[model samples]
Target: MEHRHLGHSGLMISEVTYGNWLTHGELVDGDRATACVRAALDAGITTFDTADVYAQGAAEELLGTALAGERRSALVIASKVCLPTGSGPNDRGLSRKHIVESCEASLRRLRTDYLDLYQAHRFDETTPLEETLIAFDDLVRQGKVLYLGVSEWTAPQIDAALTLVKDLGLRSRIVSNQPQYNMLWRVIEPEIVPLCLREGIGQLAFQPLAQGVLSGKYRPGQEPPAGSRATAGGRAPTFIGRVLGTPLLERVQDLVPLAADHGMSAAQLAIAWVLAQPGVSSVVAGATRPEQVTENAAAAGRPLDEAARKKVDEVLGDLVDRDPAKTAQMMAVKPAWRTA
Candidate 1:
């Protein structure tokens, strides 16, 4: 597996990180989760991404069990905070109390003493930026979290945090941003990429296949294939619904042959497209099956060349979402976690 530095930091992570978002505790059983993780390790994936909010923390526990006997020092274990994990008023957000407590809980769940990277699941509009930065700095000082990151944060929010970190001389600053970036979803390209590049923050892009839409499995007018996330009854993620449109699906079909021409699966082509973009440190791909993990891991270090990328752009012509405003807009629409 190819490795890349997380931003300008010395820490290197596998270019393809195995992440468990909706699959672990929520969608699949423990045995299946373990099998997928084993596939990732076998494929040379050294990075694992999970969150405190995924399946109300069961995901972290499952990941911990799966990697129990592995050499901890060789793995880049990452998790996130700032999401509602309980009903209590103090159970969520990036407040100092929540951050500290959450870090401790995550360590226990992951069966680790320190996190390779701890990230804000999302920007906390309710908490003071200084308080949040200070809390992260405290974790760094206490040796609980080695590096810091944020997910889905706007360019302005990141800039403000970095400025505060510098002015306050905090020990920890953001090294990465986790955002949904793929061929179909390019919202982070215009603003976040430029800003992060300038500030020395790399992007650990998630949903590199647009939740399987770019895999060419969902036909333009046909029902979503059986057993797919799109067919997961009511358990499907809301984000998957956005890419199932006829126009998008039809355009996705055009790229299937393009992928074959390059000796890649549609999924691999999609992942390679994201890696080709600037400021991307890794692509976090989740899977329910072992072969899925194996397929995704192969996408690393095999980026699309200039002509191949241009052909992809022509095939996807005007179907991509590049609006930087969508970042803040998405944050606004996300349900606010209860503070009371």
Candidate 2:
């Protein structure tokens, strides 16, 4: 329920944000999605994060329907652009054309005049950074966007964008950065976290439960439970399945007892761990049902004492300190490079 300043911006977001990544159109129907949004609002989650490509834009339409007639000023709505929406060459990326068109489309879908936070979903190396920044600045000047942010950007890319903002005296500032952070994926700590802290860019962490791995829903040597995301054949790709299988499940099993020792569910403990990190403005978690909203919000206030925090660090420390070399090599050959 606690609120935190969204970077250097005047906007303040709830410590726990409701994100519509996998659960919006994939797991929850229109009615269930509406109930989940209501649950999040009741639990004091004022920020709702989604993307243009999530469930191919069905998520935004569903959220728009859910928030109809509600007090718009009471909430912070964030959505991202980039990622291909079609087969056309200009269908995606941070080009000025796509950014502008996508923003208008998102506004129409969300039924909102302006977005509280408009983020670039990924770095578009092909698009000139100056062009992208100027486009975002134009959005701010036009009153269509309150602030600008980026998701899944490397530290250098963020620095470059900020530099461009300063050089051009752009109206928009890069106030927040969204990245995947969880017990299973602590890769951001080594460089991205420190850079955000130094630059005053708020960190909005997504996938805090590692796609439900940290929730202990998937056990080793057993099929994913019915109705679970992993159980759905087409939901997760082959590589994700391999990553979430036995080796990671073993780690989750080890951490579950640690979570219980602290009187919390694995989901809560995992989210608390992300919030404990420096520069984290909010942690975005998705929920299929109303009760999951309550559980996720509870992590905001659960005081992870020094002892518990250190214990989690000890358990996950080695896994967190990974060499980027292997990752780079994989990116070179992986067909799923776009997903990363």
Candidate 3:
């Protein structure tokens, strides 16, 4: 697989990374999860991304076991902070206490001493940015984390943090921002991409296939395929179901012929499209089966050329969601002010 430098950092990462979001302990058990990870290793995927909140932290344990016995230097493992892991006032956020404690927990779960990339799952607006930045700098100083990153942060949030790092003389700077990017989800294009590019922060995009909608598996009028993410129920209904409508599905269907012309699967076509975007360092793909692992890994070296990318845009047209406002999480409401 081809590798590229992650932003301005010297560390090189695979163009296509293996990410375990909903698959590890939720959908598959130990043996099955290990097989998929082994498949990724066989396909030459050196980078793996996960979060401490995934499956109540079981995902990290599973990934740790799956990556056992390999040379740790050959891997780039990333985990996130800032998400509430428990129902305590001090159990979450990017506060110094939470960041330090979460890093320790993640290190134990990943069965590693240091993580190549430590990411904040989201912007913790309640906490002072200095608190989070200082904590991350301490981790780097302590040799617990090699690099820093953030996920789903707005352009202003990222810029503010980067400016703080520079002005405060912090040792580690943010290198990447993880966001949802796909044919249908273009929310990061207008502002986030440009600012990140200007700041030399690469993008490690998740949901590159729009949660499998761009795979052409969901027909325009037909019910979602049994056992697919669209039909997986639970939170899947809210997250993946939005892209399963008739118009979007019909537009996605146009990618099938394009993938056929290139001798690639519809999923690969979707991934290839995301990699063609500027500042996208890696496309974090999820897979349940070994063949799925192999299929996505092949997209690493093969990028969608200019013509193919244009064709996809032409077919998608106004159906893409490019509103910068869409990046805000509805659930992230600030607490009400209390008079002393």
Candidate 4:
């Protein structure tokens, strides 16, 4: 793996970072999780991304235990907050109380005193932007957080937060913004990418494989393979299935031969595509097994040639569905929880 600076921050992160979204608590045991983490480290992936809400925080605890020894300092660790952990009204959002307490809890789970990067999982409409900005600044002042970031925030929301940070004279800076980006999802390109490029904020793209859809695993006519994430009843979630179903699978089939021509798996090709884009500092990909981590890490240096890039753009451009009705449906059911 190769290292890149995260936005304007002095911290350097691996181009391919490990993510514990499905395997930590749901699919793999602690031992397996340790093996995967070890595989990532051996492959030179120095950054790991997790969140408090992933499997109710079991993922973070598992990762902390896996990296407990001499390997700890050899990596950069990041975790997110703001998603609901319980049914209580106070259990979620980016309120000052939730933000402060969530950081403490995440630190405990990760067995660390400070985080390399702490991100607000989503925008909190209820809380005043100033209040949230001040709270984040306080974390930096207390030496508990080295940097702050936002996930899934629109351009205006990010602008407002930056303006608030300046108005309050806070020492903190928004160094990065994490968003979902892939061949199947180019929604961020129209505005978010341009904004980040202009503002000097780095982008850490998540779900670069479109939740494994671009991996060429799910065919249009066949049911999802047994033991695969999409088939794991509650694991795949309702919305994900609806979004990446038959129509998307058909689109993925068109890209398989292109991937084969490059001697890459569809997953690696998708990851490489995201890495090739401008302003992309790093890409966060989840792994279920040790080999999966190793495979994703290989995409770090596999730059796509112009012909391959053009082929991808032409194929995806023709298939992308930007229908108003589809967009409206997605916006309507989007989880209220913050994501990055």
TM-score of each: 0.95, 0.92, 0.95, 0.92
lDDT of 1 by residue, 1-340 (tens): 9999999999999999999998888777689999999999999999999999988889999999999999999999999999999999999999999999999999999999999999999999999999999989999999999999999999999999999999999878899999988886688888899999998999999989878888898897798888889977434545677556787778888898889988999999999999999999999999989999999999888968899999988887776667787784653432111111
Q: Candidate 1 versus the native: TM-score? A: 0.95
Comparison by TM-score, 3 against 4, better one: 3
Q: For residue 298, give model 2's deviation from the true position in Å.
A: 1.2
Worst 10 residues of 2 by lDDT: 330-339
Relative to the true structure, candidate 3 reaches a TM of 0.95
- Superposed Cα RMSD, model 2: 3.2
RMSD to the hidden true structure, all candidates: 4.0, 3.2, 5.1, 3.7
lDDT of 4 by residue, 297-331 (tens): 99998888889988887776644532322221344
Q: Which runs in model 4 stand beyond 4 Å of their true positions?
A: 237-239, 321-340
Model 2 lDDT, residue 38, Cα:
95
Top-TM-score candidate index: 1
Which whole-number lDDT from 0 to 100 does residue 73 have in model 4? 60
Best by lDDT: 1
lDDT of 3 by residue, 1-340 (tens): 9999999899999999999988888776689999999999999999999998888789999999999899999999999998888999998889999999999998999999999999999899799999899999999999999999999998889989999999999999999999988877777899999998998999999988877877888897798878887667445556664455776778778889999998889998988888888999999998777888999998877767889988888998877667787675523421111011
Against the true structure, candidate 4 reaches a TM-score of 0.92
- Candidate 2 has a TM-score of 0.92
